[model samples]
Target: MNLFRLDASILPGNSASAQLADAAEAEWTAAHPQGTVTRRHLGTDPLPADAWALATTASFTPEADRSPEQREALALATALAEELRSADTAILAVPLYNYGVSQHFKTWADLVIAGSDNPTEPLLKSTPTVLATTLGGGYGPGTPREGWDHSTPYLERLLGDIWQAELTVVKRELTLAATNPAMESLRPLAEDHHTQALTAAREAGRALAGI
Candidate 1:
């Protein structure tokens, strides 16, 4: 079982999103002790800003007329898509940054789609996917920030709507409560949410691997 794990978090070891992802990945690694896992730290190794542009241009231009840079961009996009193509499962760990999806992640997704759009492709056709996310605050109905979370739902659209992956999501909210003085009162709730998210992530990883 090939596992393609991608994490897009600028906070490094301090990222709550990474913690949930680590929990899930731990279960996956245990279940696939002999299976290979590919890791992409997208925040640190973001795709070039022009990757999507070059990829799209290369797709439209004749092979004979493609520039060397355009050809390289296409190749890079293909390699990125191949990570998903070769994987049986994936963990896409993302964080809600300023109430929106990570720029690095958006760029990566666009480039992958540009390079791989065939409906018959294996990767975009029901590969099991786990979306791990962390949000700085609560966004439940009636909450002050009810409509603030845009990243998690965007990921849902990309994986389920666009890519057609069988998806599961595990997220931890109020992540800033632990570190922000203004949110101190919510710290206990944050801890509870973290525990629950980790538990769900572990269970999802194990169950999906079994299937």
Candidate 2:
């Protein structure tokens, strides 16, 4: 079996999203002790900012006239697409930043599309996928920031709709409550969210492993 893992947390050491993702991945690894895992850390080694554009334009330019940079970018896009195509299962750890998906992740998603054999095709095609996401503030129903979360929706559309993965999302909100003085009153809720997310992550992982 093959598993693909992608992490986009800029603060790896102290990331709430990573914590949840770890819980999920642990279950998967435990189930598939001998499975091959492919890993990508966008936070630490981001794709070139211009690679997506280059690859996109390269498709329009004839192969013979394409520049070296364009060819390289296109190759990278193909590789990214293949990672999803070949994975038996996948875990994506993406955090809500500034109320939306991070720039690096957006770039990665775009490049994957640009590299796909058919841009509109579903690369994952029902592959099981676990998405662990965290938010510093609450954005659930009736909260002050209700509907403020732009990240999770986009992720769902990409992994579930666009890629057509069998998706499971484990979300932890109010992650900043313990540290942000203004959110002290919400600490209890934050802790509860954290615990719930971890539990959900583990369940999602086991399911992803088909156990």
Candidate 3:
């Protein structure tokens, strides 16, 4: 089995999202000892800014009239698409920024998800996907903050549409509130939801790997 791990955290070090992704990778490696792991760090190595422009041009340009820029863009897009298509399982470490996935992730999403009008040419067809998200606040399906949760549902819908994959979301939120000693002392009843979520995520990773 081959796993593609995408790390989207913008932070340089000790990022919660990156840590979670590493945890998931570790679990997967443990389960599939011989499996190869491919890592892509979007924060450190971003796609070129003109990638979209080149893709759009290539989409419209005739083969004979296509410029070098357009050719390069199309080539890049094709490479990215091929990588995603070849992966057996994909683990995305998504950190919520302003209630949504980071812009870098969104750009990567655009590159991978082929948006053609043809119904048969969907981007990722039946690829397994796992989304691990870290947020400053807690929000989920039916909670009061659900309306503000732009990350999970949007990603779920997008990935489902493209890949037709089984989507699972493991969220860790409000770590500061949950782990702070002073807050724990003052609010003894405060739920350690972040820790629970992390534990759940680790188990989920193992389960996904069929361990």
CA deviation > 4 Å runs, candidate 2:
none
Per-residue lDDT, model 2, residue 56, is 98
Candidates ranked, most accurate by TM-score first: 2, 1, 3
Which pairs clash in model 1? none
Per-residue lDDT over 1-211 for candidate 2, one digit per residue giving the tens place of the 0 to 100 score: 9999999999988888888888888999999899999999999999999999999999899999999999999999999999999999999999999999999999999999999987778999989999999999999999999999999999999899989999999999999999999999999989999888999999999998888
- 16-44, model 3: which lDDT tens digit per residue? 77766677777888889999877788889
Per-prediction TM-score, please? 0.95, 0.99, 0.84
- Candidate 2 lDDT (Cα, whole model)? 0.93
lDDT of 1 by residue, 113-157 (tens): 777865334465678888999898999788899998998888888
What is the lDDT, from 0 to 100, of the residue 10 in candidate 2? 95
Which scores greater on lDDT, model 1 or model 2?
2
Top TM-score model: 2
Off by over 4 Å in 3: 114-124, 140-146, 176-191
Better of 1 and 3 by TM-score: 1
Q: lDDT of each prediction vs. the true structure?
A: 0.85, 0.93, 0.72
